[model samples]
Target: MMSTLAERIQKQDQRALAKAITMVDNDHPDKLSLLSEISGQEKKAHFIGLTGSPGAGKSSLVDRLITHIRNMDKTVAVIAVDPTSPFSGGALLGDRFRMHKHFADPGVFIRSMATRGSLGGLSRSTKDAIRVCDAFGFDYILIETVGVGQSELDIMKVADTTALVLTPNSGDVLQIFKAGIMEIADVFVINKADLPGVQKLKTQLKEFLHIADPKSWQPPIVETISTEHKGIEAFFEACEAHKKFLNETDAGKQKRKEQLTYEVYELMREELWKDVERFIGDDPSKEIALQKENDPYQLAKEWLSEWREKGGGS
Candidate 1:
């Protein structure tokens, strides 16, 4: 069944792709096997991540980028990570509405994902979703993160190239610098450049960069008015250049290695936590004990010890 689904996905069937993504998001028990089958071979789609504060016009820029990329005669997949809805636990952003013109374009696939309690602005299954899109044969994969400030650095772990979107008049530069965002960003995009404070924002960014004194591959800053579709080409050019640097230098290879290492540890941690949860949840005695005990640390230690003794992780 999984093999057939993988085959359909390889054939570029959108239904199959959507099904695979649903399986991943729901954390289906067979998801690891399905992902492993599909990832047996590597795909070359460039993964670009755009992240920043809310109201930074990330979705607008992404819509423009979609048009730009499509004009190049290439296919693209978009994963817009949105904050979970307070009541439904589903993605709150209706990204498709903004880019609805592409609804008839078979070459463009867009999916909105909820962060689902992850502190970082990405879902736990996001990387897996990316691989699923790669398997479906896209020329590029754009990951638009939930615009939560500072903690969106997890994009570095998943994206081949990361573009940080900043807007003018927001006094965001200093906060970005303090949050160490300037250090990880490969490309800086000053979106909403037509605003009054554009120059000041650029000046502040330059001063900060000079103070930062980056070791290698200085990040490029591109001004963009996404609403007007201005600077879209330059924004992509900067991202393409960063992709080139990653390809030519040892930096890209090192990043892939680090991502793989992170994935291994993350997957293990997730699976282990699930096992422990199931163990405790299924036991009435454990539930009663939890009600009786007020000391969480001691209860946690006892549970781990008991789980291990019962061949839970052994």
Candidate 2:
């Protein structure tokens, strides 16, 4: 059944992709094994991350970019990470509404994910979904995160290029910069270009970019009216240029190596937590109380000593 499902996913079956994503989201025991089996089949897809403050038209910009990419005969996969509702523990999934026109296009695949309390601005299931898309041979994979705050900056680690979308007169540009967005942006986009203060925003961004002293590559600012599908081509061109620049520079390769190293560490941490949970069973209160009562360092030492004595650490 797993192999059949994997085959279906590799064929780009939407239903299969959805099921695979659910398996990962639920953290099924078989998920890791399945991902491992399919790991070798995955291809490298061009990853683009779009982030900004809420109401910056990120969804619309993504919609336009998808349409543009489709017109160029590229198969695109989109992972739209929505803010989870605290009361319901469910995503509103509102980003899909913006890209409704592409619902019937086979060349495009869209999945909405809830951040689900992930501090990094992406859902745990998102990486798996992207892998599935890559295995299915998508030409481009675009990730759109809920425009929250600093956490959205995490997208830089996963995306090949990160585009920070903003709007004219939003008055949040400075705040975003202050929030540490400058370091993650490969391209800065001022959406809703027809609005007043567009040039002022552009000038401000240029000045700020200079002051930020981004490593080697200076981030380019692009203007677009996403709702009208204007300037989208230029935005894509900028992305391509960034990709070229990355391929030509040592910095890009070093960044990729570091990203892989982090991923390995993340995977190891998850595995260790899973094993600990399995050993502790459903009730971890005892362990929690022990750690709270004793110093954390001492508690860790005690646990390690116990595990070692029991031959479990090996």
Candidate 3:
């Protein structure tokens, strides 16, 4: 059954692709088997990440980019992450509404995922979802983050080219520097360029770039009016250039290797924490903070010691 699904995904069947992604998102019983079967089938789909502050017009830019990319005869997939609802633990999935024009195009596939309270603005399953899309043979896989703030820098983990969108006079230039966004961004897009302070924002970005003194890739700051369909081509050209730069310098290869390592450790940490949770559940008052609980540090130490002594999971 999993192989059947994998074959359907490889054939670029959108429905099958969506089903497989749902399996990954829900952590379905067969997810690991499905993923293992499809692991090496992901070709070379470019992974582009779009992130910035709320109201930065990231969805708008992405919508326009989809049109541009399709014009060039390429297929695309999007994963738009939205804030999780506290009450229901669900997402409004409003990004679908924003990019609904592409819905009728079979070559374009879009999925909205809830952040589920993830501080990094990406859900745990987002990377896996991208892999699923890649295996399905999309030419590009674009990820739109929840657009929170600095901590959203986790884009570095999954994207080959990350574009940070901002608006004129938004004070995002200063914010990006403070949040170390400058280090992760491959392209800086100043959206709503027709507004006031456009040039001023550009000037500030250039000054920061100079101070950063980048060696291999000096991130290009492009002004865009996404509403008017302006600068979309330029934004894509910059992205293409950056991709080429990464390939030529082999920096992209090294970065991807490092990110894969991070993903491994991240998964291990999650599994270990789940074990800890199970241990606490067996003795809530003593393991967790319930009046008789031990300090968190000591509790962690004891768990580690016991885990080692038991040779893990015994």
Candidate 4:
């Protein structure tokens, strides 16, 4: 059954791709095997990240960008990460509603994902979902995060080009310096350019960029009125330019290496946590209930000593 699905995925069957993504998202038992089978088969899609403060209209911009990319005869895939509901472990998944117009187009694939309590504006399966889309032969994969924050920046690490979108008079321009966003952003978009204070925001961003001194490639600032589909072309062109710069310089190589290392560390941490849980028992509430007065550091030290004595790690 897995072999047949792998073959169908290789053939670019949408149904097969959807099934594979579902398995990855749900953390199915066969996920590792499926991902291994499809590893190294990506068609080299341009992975882009769109992130901003809520009400910055990132979804609308992505919708427009999809249309622009499709008009150029390129296939596209979108993974919209929405905030999860703490009470229900579910998400509104409202991005689908904004992008439903493309539903009839086979060339455009859209998936709405919940953050699932992950602080990084991405689920544990998001990187796997990216691979699924890339291996499915899409020309582009756009990852839209929930909002601009530390979690969003962490999530942007996977994107080859990340565009930080803002709007006029939203005070997001001030946020550029805080939260380490200035360092991570590859491009900036001032959405709702028609509104008041657009020029002031642009000036502030330019001044900040000038002071930041991005040596090899200065991030471009594009003013976009996404509702009118204006500036979409320039925004894409900036992305292309950034992609070219990355390819031509050592920055791109270094970034790829860093991303690989991060992935390895993340996976290792996940596995180690699981092993520790199994050894100590799964219910933390019980542990706390029994040892309410114990010092957490001392208990952790003892646990580590026992794990080492048992030859739990290499």
- Going through the candidates in the order shown, the clash numbers are 0, 0, 0, 0
2 against 3, candidate with superior lDDT? 3
Candidate 4: tens digits of C-alpha lDDT, residues 25-124? 8999999888888876534888899988889999999999999999999999999887776666877765577677999999999998877757546766
Ranking by lDDT, best first? 1, 4, 3, 2
lDDT of 1 at 277: 83
The models' CA-based lDDT, in order, is 0.87, 0.80, 0.83, 0.84
- Model 3 lDDT per residue over 1-314, tens place: 35599899998788899999999889898987888788865357998999888888998899999999999999999998877766778777655776778899998999987777575456678878988998988999999886666336778788999998889967857776887776778999999999999988988888888888657788999989999999999999999999999888889889878878987888788777778667667774553455666477886787678667866654
Stronger candidate by TM-score (2 vs 3): 3
Using TM-score as the measure, the top candidate is 1
lDDT of 2 by residue, 199-235 (tens): 8888888888778754778888999998788999999
| Model 3, backbone clash pairs (residues 3+ apart or across chains), number | 0
Best by lDDT: 1
Regions of candidate 3 where Cα sits further than 4 Å from its true position: 1-3, 85-87, 284-289
